[model samples]
Target: MTPTRKRRLVAISMILFAVGVATTLTVFALQQNMTYLYTPSEILAGKVPADARFRIGGMVKDKSIERGQSLTVAFVVTDGDGDMRVEYEGILPDLFREKQSVIATGSMQGDRFVATEVLAKHDENYIPRDVAEAMGKAHQKHNVPEDAAKPSTY
Candidate 1:
């Protein structure tokens, strides 16, 4: 082949290789930095990596909250089958109450979740948008109102 043609082909191949490398690196970085949400039972079943940052969602067990003189609060999060204690030192959401759904984010330290943040469900009928949408579809399949059976507002 001519030298000029060979050189052009090599340059094109190099550019394609560079693009592939950049794309792969971007994907790897995103995966490494992504966080996932799991339920309390999922955590108890060892579905989560021990040291990776993730979230756990469940109902805050009734009367499980222990408030200290300071801002520290300890509570048990349960997903029916299992429970995990979480410790946090920040003001909880206004809707945070006993027996309410909550999502805690952090890492597992031993058997406990040292939560860096806690998100409480807003109201009785208020599931997280994602959860609500999923449940809505499920309810539609079963011929039920998505919000009809929700706990009464009082």
Candidate 2:
């Protein structure tokens, strides 16, 4: 084969090899770090795997907190239709309170969720910015007061 043709073939082979290696690495990384979000109802319905790490988001059940020794606090998080007990051993967010929305990350053990991290949703009408406009329009349709319908700026 001509020298220029041989060089071109070698360059193309190297590019193909690099692309294959990159794709393989990306797939491996994704497999090791994938997680899913589930509501309390989905968890109770057996949609979440027992040993897989995932996120659960819902409202904190009223009067469900049980203060344990030290920094440990146990609470039940509910998504209207179902509830799951969560054990967290750290300082909870300042905004963490009854009936507030929260998202917890961890794996399930039996029927309980052993949370490794917890994040409390801020404000009452805490819709995403993109959805806020739609929510505002809907609230106006129902004649909700402007201040009452708006979320707390806190």
Candidate 3:
């Protein structure tokens, strides 16, 4: 083959290889960041896989919060249909309060959710779309009080 043709073929091959690598790396990064999502009702219904890292979101149960030693805090997360106990060890956000929307990412430890990271809504009526949708479904299924499933402005 001609020298110019050989050079063009080699360049094209290199470009294809680079694209393949970039695609692979992108997929790997996404896979690592992916976490299973569940609501309290789903977890109570045995939908959550044991020991699998996942995210659970719902309203923080009223009158079910307790602070322990250091930064450890225990609370109940409820989707109106059910409640799950969550244990977190970290600095909670100022907006974190009872009846507020929250999402906790962690693994299931026996009957409790051992959270690695906890996120709370900054204001009323500002819940994440996923959390709201999940809670809506659970509330509809169980006929839970709309006020209980909602993030209170109070």
The prediction achieving the highest lDDT against the true structure is: 3
Please write out the lDDT profile of model 3 over residues 51-133, one tens digit for every residue: 68999999999999999999999999998889999999999988899999999999998899999999999799798889989
| Predictions in order: lDDT | 0.81, 0.80, 0.92
The per-prediction tally of clashing pairs is 0, 0, 0
Worst 10-residue lDDT window for candidate 2 reads 127-136
TM per prediction: 0.75, 0.78, 0.83
Off by over 4 Å in 2: 127-154
Clashing pairs in 3: none
Task: Report the lDDT of model 1 for residue 16.
Answer: 100
Error of 2 at 73 (Å): 1.0
Residue pairs with backbone atoms closer than 3 Å in model 2 (clashes): none
In terms of TM-score, how similar is model 2 to the real structure? 0.78
Instruction: Count backbone overlaps in model 3.
Output: 0
lDDT of 1 by residue, 97-132 (tens): 988888888999998899999999988977676434
Off by over 4 Å in 1: 129-154
